[model samples]
Target chain A: MSRATELVLADYIVVALYFVLVLAIGTWFGKFTKSTADFFFAGRRFHWWVLAMSCVATLVGSYSFVQYSEVGFKYGFCAMTPYTNEWFVLPLFLFGWFPLMYYHRITSVPEYFHGRFNWQVRFVVTLILLVYLQGYVAVNLLTIGRIMKGVFGMPEVYGAALMALISGIYLHAGGQTSVLATDVFQGLLLLAAGIGVFLLGIAEVGGLAEFWAALPYHHRFPFARFNTPPYLHAVGNFWNDAMTATFAFYFINQGVLMRFLSARSVREGRKAMLFVVVVLMPVAAVAVSGAGWAGRAMVERGILPEDVDAGNIFVAVTGKVCGPGFQGLVLAAVVAALMSTLDTLITAVAAIGVNDVYRPVLPGRSDQHYLTVARIVAIVSAVLGISLIPVFQHYDTIYQALSDFLSTVAPPLAVPLALAMLWPRFHARAAIIAMVLGMILMITALNYPALVTPFAHGVDPSEGYSHMRSLFGLVTSLVIAVAATYLVPAAESAADRLTWFHIPRPRPARRRARHDIWHRRFRVQVVPGTDPRLHLHPETMKELDLQQGDVVYVCDARWWLGGLRSVHAVVGEPDDTLPRDTVRLSEEAVRRGYLKPRHRVILEYEEEPIDV
Target chain B: MGPWLPYVYVYGVGGCVFLASLVAGVRAGAIDLNRPADRRTLLALVAGLLLFATVHAIWIWAASQEPPVSDQAAVALTAETRA
Candidate 1:
């Protein structure tokens, strides 16, 4: 069989159109990004649905399609184990870490360490996190390059470089805003194409019943065998994929954290998290793995050759089932998956570089200077990511490479992070020791697989012991952190706002009859003041039920921007000189909110809660 | 391994993590289980877990019962049609 599959002209046209559309959407959002905050977190303005959808795009990495489909063909529905098992972490995330990060406005994981512990902890974490994020970028680029080679007969390096260049262009243009916007579009396309492949495959096989009959009995099981298969056992995958990797993705992945931070409110962020795990993930599991399942069924029925390469199962199946233009569309979805994830990781690296590395070393720089630095870092990050693609090419399978990489790096950082968030008694000294020791131990396990044998849970360590390394790392790190915390003297106390304890609860709204009149929109003017205050006409204040010293949320009338053009301010003494139809915001508030000088704005009572 | 083993492993190990996080949240005063909203949320999470487990178990059982076409039979059928 030929290494490369043939593609018709229609396929090229569809892929080209997809590239143009994504670029257009990304660059269009560029105009809205003015400051570092806007560039990194999209001005904290996205609605929950947008964040949720964009997050789904990021979560379904390009490697997800190639790797999961490869496994789906070989194993069966067990390919979905990673996606299905994320629900267990939802409670910890929503109740513990989500609010901690959101309310405290922690921009990066390293920044959180700095705030909760000390500079030493932050510096240690910053290095590990940079390696992890850049590695993630490399994994994505490599997968897309593999796809290009399988379908278009292109060299892997050139394909990887092309993808990196495309992702970097839009990320440089608009940053997080562009990433969010383009991801939403790509997320939908990804789901549609994935499901479309399965549907088309079903038709080719005669019907759903025929498809089911075509799969072998052993392949129909939902989980892999318990422990016999050293490489892909249920027990080993539980520790590596479900527990360690998933925890790292939500807790420490800077890209995923930025999605939550970009929410308009904490409540919206919670909604997005619930929707992602409960609704989107299961669908995404099917979407990403459907091609492989179909391919397996087709092979069983002799619709395709039985000797089809497992690694190229996705491309083989798409070529067999999808006709001309439709084939291109499916390929575009693969590109969408790669680009969506790559852009997020690239932007995240930029945020970490600027916030954690650059700003601390050179404090008191202008926002513009930092913004320029962020853009430059984004370009450099993409370049570095492309360079690492060659390193990952040595691994036998994409699944093994990604799983081994995440399992090794995630547990050490994940254990320390969980301890820091949940256990206030966890000291800075303990964090530093645990993180350092954890790395040493994990690296030792890489060199000496025997170290992981004890934690392998009866699985043979001879073949694929890497998956069990996470369990070993976690146990060792937890023990070291606990022992060190008690043995060492504690330093200064962590502020209540930073820990899970003493998270500020929202106060109940005032007891009063609500009226539609309070929803009135008013024209905003920049008052000559430096304080963060909003001035309202007496009648307007009375109508909105606002009082002096009350915290009010003032936002641009164009609600479609979400909360991008919004700010919270203390309501000043009513300005009798102002017109009833207008409200005046301090110059500082206007600038902070990115509010237009003469634009109409709305005001609502913001029951000021005690800061966490 | 039994068909029920995967579910057992998932909930058994995953259940510990869930409970530990819940206990930590309650201890931190971040999650007030006494509140109606909090209680409802906890219940919903438990229900969702059980629901997924039930659906997966049913799928496995149903799929297991379907008689698969033998490889030789499938290949023979294809060859016959081609001839």
Candidate 2:
């Protein structure tokens, strides 16, 4: 009997419960998503742990389960190459990409482009982002669909459509809040299921000793295995394609960037990235690759048939090892992996579409209008994703296809993005040229590989093409960017705010005594938004002995561990929204001071204030 | 802590992961164990872990079942090895 046919009612119950649980989370969080900020960015209130778990879940999609298993079936422990590559790139991301997004308060990757480069760069990059993310979403859907087809005898297209609809319902209702809230559970589910399957598969295959004995010598060691047909050579592909491309993923991918951006503070963002690198990634590496190793052993032992497709190895092994009750949970976790990634991508695509594309064209629309458009874009993204299923259907394994797609597309954009931040002289014109030229070269290389590599001899010339493709694109992009930067006049002012060197450093405060003539008092009020300045009522400003043009130094009520109390220099914004007794501080200021509302603050202006 | 110890270790690790997730959620204020509203989310999470652990236990039992090797397949394997 087929494994799907053997599924008991208990397994079905578990799967049904998981779906209901995720939907309930979506419905509950929908109440909080009243504004664009709440929906698109989760109101930037995600704690470090939530961000960390969500990043893990988002990074390890259903494709990770299937793709890594497929590679494991073919190459055993070498399946870990892609995941272990994360360690080398994690430190680079922390010091380089993490700060660029966190400090700039960026909402999207393209927004960083718009800030540093020009609208032209932003628009073009957004198009590239849409294609990449949309394709990524579809690949995940195809993976989930294949699993459902194997487990339930469902048609692949229908199953994919159903999953997409399920994801869309939640994403449409609550947006990123629903995505992050559910992601915590989904992340844990993925890890538990991954580990559970590995342990169970090992036991079914007569424990680790017998399992290892069944495999050939080539599949035993992690690093010693040379590249065979239809696989990349470790030396070039490991560093160039795997490490460099994944660095681009962490640095510039919108889904990953959004998680970092959603952290309450840069400190939290850094902590979250550290969690992904130090704790979760190593476990993840083993969890994803173990299934395939077990499958290879079972094949050798005459249990599993040799005819099984490498891509189906994960589900096939799970079906063999897991009983009815356990089968349901494993299946649910697979669905969780798919939903977790698809929801994030759906919202990311919509976010970029609205913020970078639609809103720009239809500027000054009501928030309600944009919010409505954002919802429409989410639906449209899902539909487009479902339409793209046929494209992914042709690939032998999701990992190979994704690597090829990302290696070709990502370098063109990632090169220019890195240059814009690290090289301050990088001009807008140069960024546009680099992106355009790099894309053309990457496409040409992909379409015509023999022109690039004359020594190709494997049955599949494209076997180890990822690193080669990336090398061509990156080198061409850098050459073009450097040439264009020197050739064109630079946009120094635009580049200043975008680079790492220009991050705002808190300056030492000039303190005056409480009895000083410049000292003035106002009650502090908590305000929303991230601006650093203080707002004073026109009447309050008049009472405080201040004018619109006069500069005032505002200090927080109490001091904390980092030395002197909070201080911000501001020209008073006199507003009728405030009563004369109160001075309004942004929410960021409140957090900075660790202050309660209605607390008293001292605003000190020079007795003879200098007018700007 | 006898034969069940291996199972205990498996379920115990699963339990710890569940507890850690809960603690992380509470600390993040994504779930507040104190609030009645957040208590539902906590319950759902606990239920998921329990269901997962229950499944793990079931699989552990099944894996211990010692899958039968067919006689003909064993003969074919022996012949192939000798050849």
TM-score of each: 0.88, 0.70
Question: Any residue pairs clashing in model 1, and if so which?
Answer: A497-A612
Tens digits of per-residue lDDT for model 1 on B19-57? 877887788887877655466666777777787878888
> Model 1 over residues A226-279: C-alpha lDDT tens digits?
775787888878888788888999999999999888876666687788788778
Best by DockQ: 1
How far residue B41's Cα lies from its native spot in candidate 1, in Å, is 4.8
In candidate 2, position A126 carries an lDDT of 87
lDDT (0 to 1) per candidate: 0.82, 0.68
Interface RMSD of each: 2.4, 13.4
lDDT against true structure, model 1: 0.82
**lDDT, residue B66, candidate 2:** 43
lDDT value, residue A38 of candidate 1: 84
